[model samples]
Target: MTSSTPRRDTLRFITCGSVDDGKSTLIGRLLHDAGAVPDDQVAALRDAEGRLDFSLLVDGLLAEREQGITIDVAYRYFSTPRRQFIVADTPGHEQYTRNMATGASTADAAVVLVDARKGVLTQTRRHSHIVSLLGVRHVVLAVTKMDMVAWSQDAFDAIAADYLAFAEAAGLPAPTVIPVSGVTGDNLVRRGEAAEWYAGPTLLEVLEGLPPIAETARPFRMAVQGVNRPNLDFRGYTGRINSGVVRVGDAVAVSPSGVRSHVERIVVMGGDLPQARAGQSVTLTFTDEIDVSRGDVLAAADAPLEAADQFEATLIWMAEAEMVSGRVYDLKIGARTVPAQITDIRHRVNVNTQEKLAARSLALNDIGVCHLSLGQDVAFEPYEVERELGAFILIDRLTRATVGAGMIRFALRRAHNIHRQAIKVDRNQRAALKGQKAAVVWLTGLSGSGKSTIANLVEERLTAEGRHAYLIDGDNLRHGLSRDLGFTEADRVENIRRAAEVARMMADAGLIVLVSLISPFRAERQMVRDMMPDDEFLEVFVDAPLAVAEARDVKGLYAKARRGEIANFTGVSSPYEPPAEPDLHLRTNQMSPDEAAEAVIARLRAARRLTASPPFEQPPLT
Candidate 1:
């Protein structure tokens, strides 16, 4: 089913940028000039005495008033006769980056404020990155405080040029830059006469002419947000229709369970509705007893939904905590929450320059590609096709905090894959089988410094001691688990991520897992460690000199690395900073293999991980 008409008349836009960029002042001017604000509010602005304490107009929070900054995303509703506007004034401080994300996440367009005096700063680039990442279709780079630069067209042009260059590099469409004086009410709703050199539509005129939200003609797709059980006799699946249309008597498919049935009835908030189109929140009753619940999307039989356990997505890391691979978090899409693990990080985008940075892990406000695997198969549509079903949020299970936001690019697994294993055994039993408690043993070192060899030795020793053990060697893992990975900084992050997950699973089974990886970056290694319990995790450093490592390169990786066969390769092409603190350190070059193994054994014994005595210890009895 499809609906060709647009339902909403108004368009929503958000203003985002670093603090003191005059976002609030610009918004206030727009509202005042458009006659959207009430007479009383206008009087308040005038009484505040032409100084235009713009923060007072929209900064609703008392804390915001005290701090003279927008603390939260403040929504201001106003309308011109031509089009309605709902403006979200987002915070600018780096600490409130997540708040900025929350604001722009739903906007059709964004007004990215840049100080003309300061030009484009790092925060300006960051906000632009976030706007593009969030799928904001239109961007207006409102260069504020032209009065600071004496409304100089040359100054405005210079800043505009710099921003344009950066935006092109960041993969964002060239933004329309308007040189405006927010405090003086120039080039906002009304074109001020000050900019004599410029002959362009005013900011409000441009905003008013933006294309209305386009309607999609895709098949009927609605994700069940909640089960509406008003009484014992009535059972309905409630959610907003993501695309197309839904009507009674239409054949539908329930995913990921894939049960087929006919739509018995369509119900709206008021009562039974004749039909529901995209963007309308409604409920539906099916003819058969399908095992449908939250997280499941219903689609027309003609265009059935695809089910997959893994998918690739573009993500904006909004948390202070870095995005590391193999870390498990709850993914919330629509009304569904599923356990998810990041298998790989593809690359980080440099927003201003639109260049791809080789990133291992994404810090706060970083944008990257990630390969994600759900705990179970779920139905999803590509973001380009259907944004409602494709967008997701990563929530930290422990803190219940949203750490990242994602948009599905494509599904990795097929719908009919039956190789997926269902949860059967208890975790306690699995842990008992492994000798040591299951925990992630994160190994970080330089390439060719013996991390893999030492990890192999450790695993062998644990296995011989009758303990279950698993080895997630960095190289071997890349063959299958991270086969699609590369050696870029971002790729390396994903590589460690997949390895970390395998290690996490082994550790959960109470296995003495050894991860021998030259996880050169400190931030990435710490992320792996954070995923495991304190007692179970061991950060083992395989310390050796660059010369020693190069001399012992059996794989010729060092040789190739020196010749630059690989870029961002640790110890050769890239820098490898050894861990300042580690659970255990073994100078493999100084000590023999046996001596190094004994040292590991000694450390494990001291940690109460092993009962075996050192070789020097002898039995006193008999």
Candidate 2:
């Protein structure tokens, strides 16, 4: 092996393909051939006959060794004189597709192993699609098992042609197809006896010749992880630069706040520096004291990224649960974490066939095109332009688990269309004019659960007390405001969303709004709570047994739902996720509607939410 070359650069790549495609063997062979593995470790990987077992070198986990399958992404570091390398050996099973994605996220290149006998399997295309989706521009199709195919020229050529066609169809750049035998160490570090017809650089050669990353030419962007203020005298904004260069005195903008300042100093571990470039983890001192904190993007003033809340994106559903539209997720992109929701699922891609099929939800390992609505406008770019700025991970708000990996395609046009218009008369001014505290009491439960009856009673009592109040009844809203919505899960979420928004608006207009709806989904209920200010929104769970509601189905709605005539009807076809904590929990069976309404009024009075007159002046009792 040639080991003498200058100007070494580290290239990060991952090995992935269908099961038993020789990915771990390929990486292990590279390590062994390059003298990266110690002599003792090499000895440990040998069988009783003293022959090498290449998979043993990389599949170091006990379970992996026993099962002979990779369960986790095993990262291996090695180097040649020309370049250093970080090779990730990813699993091939569909269940571990998320592990493969995690490995490929930061990769500069991908080596997708294809067994000559199997040709292009389903997972081979899956890995290729994911590699391209992750913006790994350099791809190496390692057509392995030349020895098993007896070094047949036709076998290698056929597999290579099919893969090239598939890659081209998938909009991936043409890959460098190398015929190799990972088990025999053929064409790994050097050309071997196999594949006499093939005349191409070895896998290591291709990697060494791959283009070096040119981050200095890109726009300056850094994701702030923290504000390092060890003492009040010295403060630094610390983060790894994603792209471009930042020099002292350079004008910078901190987003999504859009605060602008000049870089007064650049501090590295050694001391202060004149400048800092991409990939370096350094701290920056700004000329002006700005609110530059964690989750903010420090970008160059001239070419800052666009701040947007809505975008069209490609998402890889990593969770076992399917994608739930309107469910709020904590989207962690770069160093910033924001509340985000998948507003729409346009279509899901059949990875094996590359078909964009209509889909309502994305299952595990499913790649889909969806629309995302973030809580706040933040700096971002299309993933093709900048992976760091455009890539994100969706975390489950309740479970705190990472559910999906996403790449922003582009900011939706509606992101620009929907701008917050500041009004002169705010909610406080409107509340002051009404001379009472305005709040929303959202009643939710099963169908025929006395929500409407209790809401009417509450509104009547409020009217008698001369309180400005309005009730947004569910059926009335469906007749006018939500007339177009259906009873599907998505439509139900939208229905409740519209109702909550209207209730919030009414409450903002100095009116106590009572909303009566069977908003079954807890996610949408929580979404509504998030829309209003704390304490302004009160969820009133109109509790009633399913049997009780079904027995009292005066309109025969529950009977229709049981007969399957009403599809997606809550408590029958769909599900009702009860709130873990509701402000008011009313057992309708135990209390009459009048009693429930009075109890709610009592709660408001106890919380001091009701307007109270001045107390009688007490006589001076010194």
Deviation from truth (RMSD, Å), model 1: 9.3
The numbered model that scores best in TM-score is: 2
Cα deviation at 343, candidate 1, in Å, is 2.0
Q: State how far residue 365 of model 2 sits from its true place (Å).
A: 2.3
lDDT of each: 0.80, 0.88
For candidate 1, give the lDDT of residue 145.
93
**Count of clashing residue pairs in every prediction:** 11, 0
lDDT per residue for candidate 2 within 143-187, as digits (tens), equals 898899898889888998999989988888789999999888889
* Model 2 spans with C-alpha error above 4 angstroms: 1-7, 47-51, 612-622
lDDT per residue for candidate 1 within 1-622, as digits (tens), equals 1485434467889998888898888888878778777777666765334655555678778898778788799999987667778889999988888788888878889999999888888888888887776678899989999988888988899988988888887667668889898788899977888889888878998889998875447799988889988898988999888888888899999988879999998987567877889889888998987788887899999899887878889998888867767666889887788878787778888765666778668898788888888877888888767777888999876668889988899987553455857877755566654434455566777777777777777766765666566778877887888899887766777787778777877666656677888888775676677667777788889899988988988898878877877677777777786887999888887887777777776677677665532223323323
lDDT of 1 at 611: 51
Provide the lDDT at 385 for model 1. 72
Which pairs, if any, clash in model 2? none
Pick the lDDT winner: 2
